[model samples]
Target: MRATFHLKTLTVAIAAFSVASAASAAGLDRSGQDVTAFLQDGLYAEAVYTYIDGDVSGHDNAYIGPDKKAYEQGKKIDDIAESYDFFRYGVKADINDTFSVGILYDEPFGAAADYSGDNNFVARGDLDASVNAISGGKASSAADAGLKIGQLTAGATQAGAAAANFAAQAQTATTPQAAAGFAEQAQAAQTQAQTLAGQAQSLGAAVAAARAEAATTGEGTNVEVRTESVTGILGMKLGENKNFQVYGGPVMQQVQADVALRGIAYGPATGYTTHISSDQDYGWLAGVSYSKPEIALLAALTYRSEIDHSLNIDETYPLVAALGGDPVQGNKIDITTPKSVNFDFQTGVNQTTLATAKVRWVPWTDFAIVPPLYNEVSKRSTGDDKGLPLVSYDEDQWLVELGLAKRLSPALAVTGTVGWDSGAGDPVTSLGPIEGYYSAGLGAKYNLTENWAVSAGGKYLWFGDAQGQIPTKTIVSDFDSNDGYALGVKVSYQAK
Candidate 1:
């Protein structure tokens, strides 16, 4: 009886072990497993978390001239815009040796805010007519003075000649009294002409001075518009093997934008107040990935479809508008954000090292926000000429990453990586923010048991200068930015 019992016990143990192995394998086939997650696991399964934050700023200055003598100084001018922020979070789970799933949430795109009002370019009534008017007036006055001077000088010369001839005749004996009277008249005429000529010279000198000053000064009108945006995304993944995976999710996006005039004051008497408000939008994304572990090669392609949105915009003006002020009104706008494509790849170098690369393209040229028809018909509508021009926004970007990992213990490991992105420059749109540069990251993982694990990591991204066009006709310069940081945490449980 003892021998039989031993045999049964051994068989049961073997069956249990086989069942656990099968379960683990099944878990690996789900969608959440990724190359990064796989590498983190080789180190150990540890609870992980991540976060990211950053900002961008720049300016545009423009000079306009109506004529050679009456040119406006820099008309459109915008100082460095308000700073921006970015954030993200991610989590992962390992079902078994081959199956895993995870979720990632982040804000991938954003915009800056412009608020400086130094130039009188945009504001109505800020236009300087003094220089142009004074310059032209001076030129006209100088011409008239020249004409008067010429006439007076000629008359004086002619009168002097006639007086001499009359004197000569008088000296020859005929009428002395008549000749004396003629001489007196001629002298008086000469004196009057000289006085008039002096007056004309004085006026001419004043006009020349005025013209000189106008030549050195510049004046013109300018306009500037500021806009800000925030995007939030949530994604879920399910992976069953190193070969196939799927991810899909929803997003919430918000934008707070405004158009205002610089170098202009707002008051009850001025009938001009700024338009300030916010708009909210929604979007979603889904995709799949395929990887080959044996070959140490991986490829992930993702498509983010576009989102259609309508904004309930509130237009506000001075209270005087309500109290018998100019035509004032408020309304909503309809706009659409563009879609994008993301392709990422990874290749293992050795047991402890790996290489990674990625490419992304965003179709922002299709983005537009337009006011309703009724609002357009309203005289109070501020939407006229507010449409963004169509520009080629086709962006082809690339990134490369190199990483090394070290095993600290049987159940713990650590990794470090560095990467470079070469793509941010001369972007389209007045407010599109583009940043590209170097990034460094550190990650750690811990194995809670044979079937459970967790991981955590942090990354810092340093961006180079970003450039774009502004409505002010000025090239926003000194467009440098600071470093961004991201912190991430994830946990995984294995069934086998």
Candidate 2:
């Protein structure tokens, strides 16, 4: 007979490494959407807290104009990645040998970033008529001023030409009566020319004054997004020995955000801002699992469906107000969250050792946030009525992690993991300017008693380099050699 080994009582803490994989994920992916807590043996309950922080900084593009009068481009952008954190709680109970139920809560998807320092992302109140800027007689927002200037100049030219023609007719008239009539027309034409010229000068002064007041007061670009989810699950064990199980449940989620677009990098879209009111919606998740206690093995595959939401959004664009429309518009937009697939597997290698692996995929390329007002305003510049969304991803995301756990003592276990995340795209959104990351983590779990335990873990991330692009697919910045970290702690209880 062959000898067999089971690590049910020694290496169960192997799940600890999976808790903080959120430190380096793609496409607004956070929390890793982990469901391992619900898979624990018997009645189990756990609460996990994780924190992430990074310094994402780079240089802004720069170009100076000729004649030494204009200098635009080549400036430094400060750290934009703000400190972020969240919490997760899960409780599971077995009603009998063949049925189980559980509830889980987690903040799954989000982002937070702010641009500061002397960069294009900040709002400047100074507009130079010499330089092509808002109200510089070049940008579309200055259309009214440009048109008025053109009309006044044209009127003055027409009046002067008419005066010259009438004066010549007065000089050559055969009769004094006809000459007086022509002379009167010439004098009136000269007066009209003077009046138009004076008006033209006044209009020019007014445009200069407006340009002086073009500078607005405010901070630079910034964005904050948050989401919350709660899931209720029911599982039924099938077949003899109850080794195979199928489970699924409904998920409730809420999302909200605030955004500000400032500075010259956005061109006419500068000073644009948006607010998304908190919206709650529903979705469903399904999965299947198999286990073999003799070898201490478990494998499961899960799928989460996309949730639909009607988000109420308010937007403000400087150009919209310039184009004779309300600066702020409030409307509702239809948005659907992305769907995902997750696979988890673990098995005991020996009496005191365990091996584990996890893989996750999200179709982010199919996701986009298209605010109606922003899209409509974009049509004038893009010339395509289809317009563009304020935010979107260029690629899907794939994350893979492998881990090992070993029992160090009767009541303690240690775990280690190495992971890789494929970011949403190479040239990602300017808001979150990192492509993805490579990560490594270490964790330990100590059992205090038969029903209680504590686990803590930390991960160090090496972010991948990427180019940041705005909605028009314009590359304005580059972020490279950046890094971040994630830390997590969990308190767990089990009654097996």
Candidate 3:
């Protein structure tokens, strides 16, 4: 009985790399429903910590003007995204042969971005300054000046032609006064032509100066997002052999976000600071598990419902102060997390080897966050009757993984995996700019004693090209050929 239980423990232990490999998949989804998987039968407790680091650097190929580009070539922005860390801890215990319970704590979603370097386009004041310089009547002013100049030139030309005809007539005129009148008109027409030309030159020069000034005053920005979740589960066994079970419970989560907009690319968001926080939002989970000890087979299917949050937001728009409007606004907003389904299966190929496969599906398209006042103001400004949300997902996401685990000794086991994610979308939001991923993982577990074990896992992910977009589907930046690494360490103890 002890040997059989040990092999089962080894099977679950070696597959720990599945969590590490999931760090690179769809929309801030670092945990991948692993909390449910972690609640499998056993008097077990474990803690896992993971670290993720990635960098995206590329030039902005979008043309701003004849003389300026979005982000200059050869100027690389390193560490645009700060490294993030995750910690999860859980405990599961069997109350009897037919009942089990567990609780887990984890961070499910987060994001961070900073643009601080001198070479960073946003940091260098390109976006806001550009908006201010051009949007402040400069273009219209220049166009008006050009139109006036054109009209003046046409008048001057007609007057000059008339003057020439008069001069020719003067040469054969009957009186000296008529001859003098013709000469004066000819000189006046020439002076008017020169004056209009001079005004056009002045207007052109002013536009150039304003544009140069706009390119010079922006500061960098820092954005941070955080979430915390707690889940509780109770499982009950059924069937004559107790091989079938069902588990479910409530989930609570807290979320907070702060964004500082400093660049012109953000448009109205420029010079604005927005914040939102929600606590104790609730969701639920349900699943069924089937196992056959004789064949060493296990399969589980789990569903997690979306959590809705009503958040009170505090926003400050410094530009509003300049316009003699309110600088700060307080309002409520609604946001929802995506619903997901997860499936996990494992079977023993032999006494020493096991095979595992897992799949996760998240309906991201229905997820969105729209702050009330911000939405109202934005729609009015853009003349859109229906306002756009602050953030939204355009498509659903999928993740698939396959792996093999082998026992090297009674106390040692190893595993390797390959995975793929279909991603949330191609042109994604700038806040969490990432595409799908292709990944590989490796992990090892060593049993220090009959009741304690330690495991470490690492994964490498190659991300697809990502295009970051604004609310109106404008592509601001492209991240090509980016990749990241995730490392996880876990420790577990089992009750005797």
Best by the lDDT measure? 2
Give stretches of model 3 more than 4 Å off: 1-15, 36-39, 65-76, 118-121, 125-129, 132-218, 322-324
Clashes of each: 40, 7, 3
Kindly indicate the candidate among 1 and 3 with the higher TM-score. Answer: 3
**Structure candidate 3, residue pairs in collision:** 125-218, 127-264, 128-264
User: lDDT tens digits, residues 460-485, model 1?
Assistant: 77765654433322232334554555
Worst 10 residues of 3 by lDDT: 65-74
lDDT of 2 by residue, 264-318 (tens): 6665677778999999999999999998876778898989999998999998875
Comparing candidate 1 with candidate 3, which one achieves the higher lDDT? 3
Task: Flag clash pairs in model 2.
Answer: 61-74, 62-73, 62-74, 63-73, 125-215, 125-216, 126-215
Rank candidates by TM-score, best first: 2, 3, 1
Candidates sorted by lDDT, best first: 2, 3, 1
Each model's RMSD to truth, in Å? 19.1, 9.1, 10.9
Would you list the C-alpha lDDT of every candidate in the order shown? 0.41, 0.80, 0.70
lDDT of 3 at 277: 66
What TM-score does each of the candidates earn? 0.49, 0.83, 0.79
